[model samples]
Target: MSKRDFYEVLGVGRDAGERDIKKAYKRLAMKYHPDRNPGDDTAADKFKEVKTAYEILTDPQKKAAYDQYGHAAFEQGGMGGGGGFGGGADFSDIFGDVFGDIFGGGGRRGGGQHRAQRGADLRYNMELTLEEAVRGCTKEIRVPTLVNCDTCEGSGAKKGSSPTTCGTCHGAGQVQMRQGFFAVQQTCPHCHGRGKIITDPCGKCHGQGRVQETKTLSVKIPAGVDTGDRIRLTGEGEAGEFGAPAGDLYVQVHVQKHAIFERDGNNLYCEVPVSFTMAALGGEVEVPTLDGRVSLKVPTETQTGRMFRMRGKGVKSVRGGAVGDLICKLVVETPVNLSSRQKELLQEFESTLAGSDAKKHKPRSEGFFDGVKKFFDDLTG
Candidate 1:
C-alpha cells in the first residue's frame, strides 16, 4: 500500500512547526491507541500509521530526506526504510521534554542526588540606650538554634548500627518509571531522596540529625549605630542538613528615644528655655548634650525660637561622616509671682518705658501694631 503523506498522516500542514506535529501525533495516538481500542483491528492499524508518521517527522535527518525525496528516499531504491525510522532511536529524550515534570522523569534518572540543604538564616533584635549606642558595648546573648546531633555525628544514624542503602532505590536517590515510550525518574519513596534507611534511630535527636540548643554568643555593638542598623554574624544560624554550610545570624539594632535631645540623621536638636531678662539683655546659658553640659551665649535682643548651633556636639555616623552640630532653639519664659514691692517697681518701669518717645525697647511690637492699623483701614475703605 502506498503510504500517506507524512503531513497528511499527522493532520498537519506542510509548513507546520515541530510543536504542531507533536500535538497532532499526540491526538491521533491517544484516539487510536491499541490499549484504548482493544480488539479493534482498524484502530490498531491507525495507531501504527500515526506512530510511524511521528517517528519520521520528529527526526530532523529523516524528515529532511522524506521532504526532499518523498517516500522514495526511504524505499529499497533509496534511503532504506521510512516506516521504522525511530525503531532504535533515543525516544527517552523526546519523551522527557514533553512529560518530564509530570512523571518526575528526565535528568534525575541517575541514583545519587544532593540531599543536603542549606540552613535557614536567623534574626535577633537588640535594643540599646542612646548612650550605649553612642559609646558602643559588648553583650552576651543566648539564642535557640539547631545544632548537629553528637550521638549520630549529624548522620541521622544510630550510634552502633548506621544507616543502610535503600533497597527500593539501591542507594540511588531516585527511581525510574517506564510509561509507554517514555522513561521518568522520580525521588525514591522509601529513601525520600536520602538514599539511606536508618533502621535504628539516634536516641538524642531520633532520626532528625540535629538537636535544639541554646547557644551563648558575645555580640559587639559599634559606636554611632542608630535604629534599623544590622550587624551580620556568619555561621551562627541553624545547622544545615548532612553537614552543609550553616546560615548567618543578623543582629538588628534599635536605639531608644532620648529625654534631652531629638536626633535627625547625625544632628541633634534641643529646646532651651531662657529667662526673659537673660534673653533681652544678653547672658550665658547652660545647654545639655550627649557629651556634657556646655555654655551658650545669648546675644542682646535675642528673640524666641532663635537657633544657636554648637558644632561637633552631635552624633558621628556609623557609616563614617563628619560629626554634626547640636541646635539649641531658644524659648523666652515669662516670669510668674511678684511681691507688692516688686509689682510697684514693675509699674514704675512700665511707666518709664511708655514715656520714652522712641521704638527702642519694643520695635517688633510697634511694627506689628502699624501693620494691624493699616489692615483695618483697608477693610473700612
Candidate 2:
C-alpha cells in the first residue's frame, strides 16, 4: 500500500505554519496516547502514524525531497534512502521535538537532562507610619523561609555517601513503552522524575535539602512611598532545592493612618480648626505637618471650608518629581462654655446688629431659604 500524505495524516493543510503543526500534533498525541486510549490498538497505530508524519513534514530537507518526488523520495532504494535516512535512522531527534520536555528529558540529547530548579518567591507585609512613609526609612524585617542545609551542603545525602543513579530509569529520568507501533515516554516513577536517589538521607534535613529558618534583611524605603508600594530584595527568598538559584523577597508596604494629615498621591490634605473670632478677624494659627508644626494665616472674612495651600509642604515623590503642596481646609469652631459676662457682652453686641438686615450678614442662609421656597412653590404647582 502507498504511504499517506504527511499533512493529511496530521489533519493539517500543506501550508500550515509551524505553530499550527505543533498544536495539531499535541492534540492528536494526547487523544491517541496509549495511556489515554487504553488497550486500543487502532488508536496506538494512528498515533504512531501521526508522529511519523509530523517528523517528516517538520524537517526542511526531508520536506523538500518529499514535496519534489512524493513518497518515492523516502522509498527503499530512493535518493534519501541509503545516506543516514534509511531504516537505521534514529527517531529520537523527532521524539525530542514532540515529547522530550513533557517527559522530563530536557527536550534534546546531550543537553544534560536535569538541573536544580529556582526557588519560590516570597512576600512580606510591612507597616509604616505616615511620617516614615513620607520621609523614607530603612527597616530590618525577619522572614521565615527554607534555607539550604549545611550538613551535606544541599546534596541531601549523608556526609560520606552520594546520590546514586535510579535503577528503574537508568539515569535517563524517563521511560519509553511500546504500545502497538507507537512509543510513549513518561517520567520514571521510582526516582520521581529526578533520575537520582539518595540512599543515605541527611540526618539534619531528613534528605529534604533545605531547613526552615528566619532571615533578617534590611530594606531601604524610598521617600514618598505610599501604601501598596513594594520593595524587592533579590536572592533573599527561600533557598532552592539541591543548590538552585534563590528567589526574590518582596516587601509590601502599608502606610498607617495619620492623625492630622491624609495623603492623596503626592498632595496632603488636613483640616485646620480656628476659633470663630479668628475667622472674623485675621490671625496666625499653627498647623501640623509631616515635618513639623507651621504657622498659617487665617485671612479676615475667611469662610468655613475654605482651602489654603502651602507649597512644598507635602511629600516628595519616591518616583522623583517636584514636591507637592499641603492643602489646609479651615473649619470655624464656635466658642463653647462661655462665661456669664462674655455671654452678656455677646447678647448686647447681637442686639446692636439685629435691626441692621441680618440677610446682609448671613447671605448664604438667606439664599438657601430662597431656594427652599422656590422648591416648595414648584412642588405645589
Candidate 3:
C-alpha cells in the first residue's frame, strides 16, 4: 500500500512550522497510541505511521530531502526503507522532550554527571538576660554538628583512591525505568542518588564526607533585641556533601525575664513602693532605672497605682526607632510594726478626722458607702 503523505499522517499542513507539526503529532499520536486503543490493528499501524512521519519531518537533513523529492527520496531505490527509519531514533528522546519538564527530567537525556547538593541549615537557640539584650553583648557558643572530613577533604575516599561514578546510573544519580513506551526516572539504588561510590572509605568520616564535631562560635547580640529575633550567620551550618556550598546558621534570640521590670515591645514597666506620708506630703522619691536611680516627685495626695513616666529610660530598639519610656506604677505602703509611742501618735492623728470631717479625709470610703446605701434602697423601696 502506498503510504499517506507525512504531513497528512500528522494532520498538519506542509507549510506548518516545526512547532506546529510537533503539536499536531503529539495530539494525534496520543489519541491513536496502541496502549490507548488495544486490540485494534488499524490504530497500531496508524501509530507506527505517525511515528515515522514525525521522525522524518523533525530531522533537518531528512526533512530537506523529503520536501524536495517527496517519498521518492526515501524509496527502496533511494534512501533504504522508511519502515526502519522509525527504529533508528530512540522514542525516549521525544518522550523526554515532550514530558520531561512535568516529570523533572528535562535537559537530562542521557546519564549526565550530577552536581553536589547543598548542606542543610542549622538553628541555635541562645538565651540572654534582659540587661544583655538591652546593652548588647557578645557570647561564645558551642554547637555539635557535622563538618567536612579533614583527612579526606570531604571526598569520602581513601588517601590513595578516589570515588567512582555509579555503575547503575553512570553518575546521573537517577535511573530511568521503561513502562511500555513511557519512561520514569527515580533515584539510583546503588549509590542512593549520590552519583558516586567510594570503594575504599575514608578512615575519619567512614565514606560520609562529613564528621561529627563540636564547633565553638562567637555571636554578637544587638541592643534591644527581643524574643523571636533571629541572627543569621552565613556558611556556618553543617558541611555539604562532597564539598558543596555550606548552609547558614541562625541564632534565635530568647530574652530572659527580668527581676524588677516587665517589657512590652520597647517599653519597660516597673512598680515602685512609696510611703503614704511621702505620697500625701508630695516629696521626691528615688526610683530605679536601667541606667541609675532617678528622683521622681510624688504629687500631694497621690493615690496608689498612679503611673509616672520616665522618658528615654527604657530600652532602645534594635531596629533603630525612638527610645521607649519607663512607666513606674506607685503603690502607697502603710506603716507596720509601730512602736508604742508611734502607735499612740498615729492614734492621735486618726482622732483628728473621726467626726463629720472624716468624709473630707477619706472621700473614697464615703463614696463606697453612698453607692451601697443607694443599692439597698432600690431593692427595698
Off-target runs (Cα >4 Å) in candidate 1 are: 1-98, 101-112, 337-359
TM-score of 3: 0.71
TM-scores of all models? Answer: 0.70, 0.72, 0.71
Ranking by TM-score: 2, 3, 1
What is the C-alpha local distance difference test score of each model? Answer: 0.81, 0.81, 0.84
Task: List, residue by residue over 1-381, the lDDT tens digit for candidate 3.
Answer: 786889988888888889998888777766766556779978766777788898789888888888998888887667636344355443446545554422344334444455677888999999999999999999999988889999999999987899998898888887887755556676689998778899999998899889999999999999989999999999999899899998889999999999999999889999999998988889998888889999999999998999999999998999999999999999999989999999999899989978888889889988899899999999999
The ten-residue window of minimal lDDT in model 1 covers 101-110
Runs in model 2 lying further than 4 Å from the true structure: 1-112, 378-381
Per-residue lDDT of candidate 2, residues 1-381 (tens digit): 566788888899988987888889887876776556678978767777777667678788888887888778877688556422224323345445565533334335423435677888999999999988999899988999998998988889988888899998888776776654445676677876677999999999999889999988889988899999998899998899788898999999999998888999899999999988899889999998877899998899888999999999998889999999999999999888999999999899778755548677777877798899999999999
Please report the candidate that would top lDDT against the real structure. 3
Candidate 3 lDDT trough over 10 residues, lowest sum = 101-110
Q: Which pairs of residues clash in candidate 2, taking residues 3 or more apart in a chain or in different chains? A: none
Candidate 1 displacement at residue 311 in angstroms: 1.4
